[model samples]
Target: MSSPRASHRGPATMFILVGFPGMEDSHFRLAFPLCFLFMVAVLGNCTVIYIIKVERSLHEPMYLFLCMLAAIDIMIALSTMPKMMAIFWFKSTNIAFDACLVQMFCIHSLSGMESTILLAMAFDRYIAICYPLSHSSILTTPRIAKIGLLAIIRGAALMGPLPIFIKRLPFCRSNILSHSYCLHQDVMKLACASIKVNVIYGLVVIIFAIGLDSLLISLSYFFILKAALGLTQEARVKALGTCISHICAVFLFYVPFIGLSMVHRFGKTHGSNIHTVMANVHLLVPPVLNPLVYGVKTKQIRHRMLRAFCRMKSC
Candidate 1:
C-alpha cells in the first residue's frame, strides 16, 4: 500500500511563477514601468473611492456603480501586483499552491464582479435615458444595494469552486506558471491529470460570467441608443453623454481581457513574452484607466476632485 502522496494524481504543494520566460535579466528594467503603473492604479482608484464617499451629490445610482467598479478594480489589482512586483524586482516567484489558488480566486472573482457592475451601470444608464420619470423608482438605494450584492454573490458562486478543483489535480508537469500572476488557465495547464473537467468548468464560468454580462451590457446600450435616436439632437447628445465614461470603462475592462483570452487559447505557442506581457496588461491597465476615464469624462466627479484638490491646497 502506497501513501496518498505517492500517487501520481496527488496534489502539488507549491508553484513557481515565471514572471517572464527569457526576460529574467531584464526584470529590473521591467520593474520601472510596472511599479509606476501599479502606483498609478492604486492612487487613482483610491481617489475615485474617496471622492465618491465624500461627495453627497454622487450618492446616485450611477456614481454608486462607479464606486463599486473602482473598488473591484482595486481588489483585482491588489490581488496580483505585489506578487508580480516581487517576481520582477526580487526574483521571488515561488508561491504556495494554496496561495496561488487564492490569488486566482481574487483575480477571477473580482473580474466577474467588475463585469457585473458594468452591466449594472449600463442598466442604470438605460433607465435614466429611456425612462427618466421612472429611473428613480427603479434604481432606488435599496435596489442598488441588492444589485451590488447579487453581483458579488454571482461572482463568488461561479469562481469559488475553481481553485478547489484545481487543487485536487496532481501537478506532474512543471509547476512554473507562465504569467507573473495566477490565472485559471495558467494553473490548469500544469496539472498532470486529465483537465477536461477544469477546462469545461472554466469555459462555463466564462460563458456565464463574461459572456452573459457582455450580452446584457450590449443589449442595454442598444435600447439606450434606440431611445436616444428618438430625441432632438441636443437631447440625444445629453442622453448619450452620460454613458461615455461607462462605455470607455467597458472597453478598458473587456478589450485586454479578450486579448488575453485569445492569446491564451490560441497563442500559447507564440512568444511566451507576448503572452506574459498581455496578461500583465490585462490585469494592470483597467484599474489605472477606469478611474481616469471616469474622473475625466464625468463632470460631477471631476468637479468634486478639483474642489477637493483646492481645499487640500488651501489647508
Candidate 2:
C-alpha cells in the first residue's frame, strides 16, 4: 500500500498547460501571426543550413559555427513551436507528465546548447581577430567538430538531471502550468515535496551553463575589441561589422529572457498576461530574427541566398 502522502498527491499522469491564460477566445487571432513567424523561422533556418552545405566557400570555421547555430535554431523552433501552435489553434493543451518532462528537457537542453554555440562563435571571433596568424590551425575542422560535440554533451549532461529530480517529487498542488511550455521553475513550484535541492541545482545549471557562457562570451568580445583597436581604421570597421549579426543574436536570445525572468520573480503587480506574452516572445524572436540578421548582414550568406533565389526564379 502507498503512503498517505503519496495517495494524496495530484495526478502524476497529466499536466495542463495554461497557454495564454486570458486569451481563451482569441486563439485564432493569435495563431495566425505566430504560425506565420514559425514558418519563416523554419524556412529561413533551413535555407541557411542548405546554403552552407552546398557552398564550398562557406566551409570555414566561422561559417561552420553559423551552420551549427542555424541547426540549433531549428531544434529550438521544432521543440516548442508545434506544441504552442497546437494549443493556440486546436486547444490541445493537455500534455502527459512524461511528455511534459521530455519537452522540458528538449527546450532547456537545446537552449543551453544554443548559448554554448554563441560562446563558441564569440571565442572563434576572438581567436580570428586577436591571433589571426594562428586562426586556421587553432580552429581546425576536426577541432570545430569536437567543439560542436562537446557543446551538445555539456547541455545534455547538465540539464538531463532536471526532469528526473522533478519526477521524484510529489506534486500535490495544481498540475496546471502557467505557460505554454514546461519550464523548470514553473513545474518545480507544483511539487509538494521538498524542492530545495532542485532549486539549488537549477540555479547551479543556470550559473554554470548560461552565466559562465555569457561571461566567457563577453570576455571574448573584450579581447576581440582590444585587438580590433590595434588594426587600421578599415580593418577595425570590418572586424566589428562581422560581429554585428552575432551581437544582435546574443541580445535577442538573452535580453527578453532576462526580462521575462525578472518579471516573473518581481512582477507581483503585473498581470499574468504580461508574463505569458513575454514568454512567447522570448521563444519566438530569436529563431525568427537570427536567420534574418545573419542572412542580411553576412556577405557570403547574402550572396549565396541571392544566387539561390535567382536560380529558383529562373526555374
Candidate 3:
C-alpha cells in the first residue's frame, strides 16, 4: 500500500486539503466572519491611506508611518485573504509550489516591515514627547524618509532567505497545510528533511528582528511614560491619550503574536483550536483595528478623514 506521502506526490493531488479531523463543519462558520473581516480591513486601511494622501496637513512622521502601516496591511491582506476566501468559498485551495513560496515571502516581509515601522513610530513618539524642544531636528522629514527606506531594506533582508530555504526542503509528504495560508512553522512541519536548521534560523530571525524591535519599543514607551509623569496632571492626561491608540495597536499585534508562538511551541496538541484563533487574530486584528484606533484617537487624522469622506460624498 502506498504511504500517505507518496499518495499525495502526483500533481493531481496538489491543493487536496486533508483538513483537521473535525474541522469540516467549522469551515463554513469561520468563512463568513473572516470574509467580513477581510473586507473591513482592506477598506479601512485604504481610507487611511487616501486621507493621508489628500490632506497635506497630515503629512508628518506619525501619519507617514500610518501610511506605511496601511500599505503593509493592504499587502498582507492581499497575500492571505483572497486565497483563504477562495478556499472557503469555492473549496479550491490549490496553490502552486512557487506561489506558496511567493505568498510566504510577501506575508512575512510585509509583517516584518510593519513591525519595523511601528518601532520607528515609537521612536518618533519618544522624541516628540521626551525631547519636545528638539523633536523637529531629531525627526526631520529627511530622517523619516531614511527610516522608511531602512524599514523596507531590513524587512527584505530578514525575510528574503526564508522562502528560499523553505523551497529547498524536500516535501515528500503532507502538502496539506492545516492553516489557511502558508505560515512558517506550519510549512516547516510538512518537510520530509530534518527541520532543525530551519527552526533555529526562524528563532534567530524572530529574536533579532521582531524580538529586538519589540524590546526597543517597550523601552521607548518606558521612557515616554516617565516623561509623561513629570508633566502636570492635565498635560499627562493629554500625552497619555495621544499614546493610547498606539499602545492598543502594539498590544493587538504583539500579544496575540506571542501567544500564538507560545501555544504552537508548547501547547500545540492540547489547544490547537485556541492557537488557530489566536493566530488568525494576530494576522487579522491589527489590520482591521489599527486605522480605526488611530483615526478615532488622533484628532488631526480624524478631521482630515472626515473632510475627505464628506468631500467625496458631495462630488
Per-model TM values vs. the true structure? 0.95, 0.95, 0.91
In the predicted model 3, the residue pairs found to clash are: none
lDDT of each residue in 40-103, candidate 2, tens digit only:
9999999999988999999988889989998988988998988988988988888888999999
| Superposed model 1: Cα runs more than 4 Å off | 1-9
At residue 81, give the lDDT of candidate 3: 82
For residue 266, model 1's alpha carbon misses the true position, in angstroms, by: 1.2
Candidates' C-alpha lDDT: 0.87, 0.86, 0.80
Clashes of 1: 0
Q: Encode model 1's per-residue lDDT on 29-67: one tens digit a residue.
A: 888888888889889999998988888988999999989
lDDT of 1: 0.87
Could you tally the backbone clashes for each prediction? 0, 0, 0
Model 3, poorest ten-residue lDDT window?
A: 11-20
Q: Report the C-alpha displacement of residue 119, candidate 3, in angstroms.
A: 0.4
| Best-matching candidate per lDDT | 1
What TM-score would candidate 1 get against the native?
A: 0.95
Candidate 3 local lDDT, residue 174: 63
Candidate 2 all-Cα RMSD: 3.5
